[model samples]
Target: MPDQPVDQTTPRRGSRLSVDDWLEAATQILVDDGIDALKISRLSARLGVTKGSFYWHFTDIGALKSALAEHCRQSQATAASRIEALASLPPVERVEAMARLLSDPRRWAMESALRRWAVTDESIAASVDQLDCRIFAIAISAMRELGFSETEAHARATTLLYAGIGYVHAHGRLNEATVDDLHVIIEILTRR
Candidate 1:
């Protein structure tokens, strides 16, 4: 007898996708199609696994959502750490560096999608709120180094934070011209 070709359509009793695999797929689905697309059935089909595989990792959709929240938090922390590394630089350079990094389209899309989802989802909203504070703290610190008073820095940081996020979402690109315009905006906001 010869070895048989395994039938991929059949769900093997012990075969299953790992938690990381699930998270990756879930993240892609969310990024591509939004939170509504994260159904277990869809994920099983997408991953070539059975619903049992998903169930093995998560007890329910809520459990999966909780995992997703944690993943988002981790991602935000990673990005913030990268931004925080610029603290050693002068204020203007720090702000410019952060702006340029964030202005890329792909990065903008990821952040925007997560933010839009958070707008309606309470769980995501809470996670985003925490992320927002971390982002604000860095921006304010940079503004203060640029000669703005504490109150002025906070106000300017908050304004620019909203503007940068909105610009990426609305314009989809922060090219040289856009970045130049943003610099003007920053100047206006930080002016005493």
Candidate 2:
């Protein structure tokens, strides 16, 4: 979460949580509990702060939710820059790193939480869809780095990305994919 400048009237010292702090607390509540659990009182209490602090940052819960949705959109807006960074890496290394999408458990959990939230909110759902397309584009970039034609890149990238998505969403209930499973996948996907 990007840090917004603190309100001037807010104390510069002890327990003075910034706007970013509130948003992060809200996100934790959203991911760990659910959207319904995102009450201002609950979040303030969780952060060991007062409601005054939250109010200092946001007018109300709706504003906070809107901010969260906007944050989600802004966070994924780095696809082009990310692709450029990936492009700088050796082709084989880039492909290997991109194909290891399921390696981060925390990221998977957050994405899964956002997906669940999307089911009930159109704004959030749109954000998720845009994020999905952006991530898919990055995967496609990775495949192209391996010298695959656009059509071939789309097919392989789609297959690999969808597989990673499925694994992430189902990961809470199912056993995690083993290192060997990932090795076989990385080997197959990176094969020229």
Instruction: Specify the highest-TM-score model's number.
Output: 1
Candidate 2 on 1-192: residue-level lDDT in tens? Answer: 999877653344356687787778778888888787889899877776677878888899999998987776665455334534665667566656654543567667777777888899898788777766766776777778888998988888788778777877877799987767877876687678
List clash counts for every candidate, in order. Answer: 0, 0
Model 1: ten consecutive residues of lowest lDDT: 168-177
Clashing pairs in 1: none
Q: Please tell me which predicted candidate would have the highest lDDT against the true structure.
A: 1
Residue 15 error, candidate 1, Å: 7.0
Q: What are the per-residue Cα lDDT tens digits for candidate 1 across 1-192?
A: 998786664444456567887888788888888888889998887777778778889999889988987888788777777877877877777777777766666676678778878987887777667667766877899888778888889888898788777765775354433767767775676556
Lowest summed lDDT across 10 adjacent residues in model 2 is found at 75-84
The TM-scores, one per candidate, come to 0.76, 0.75
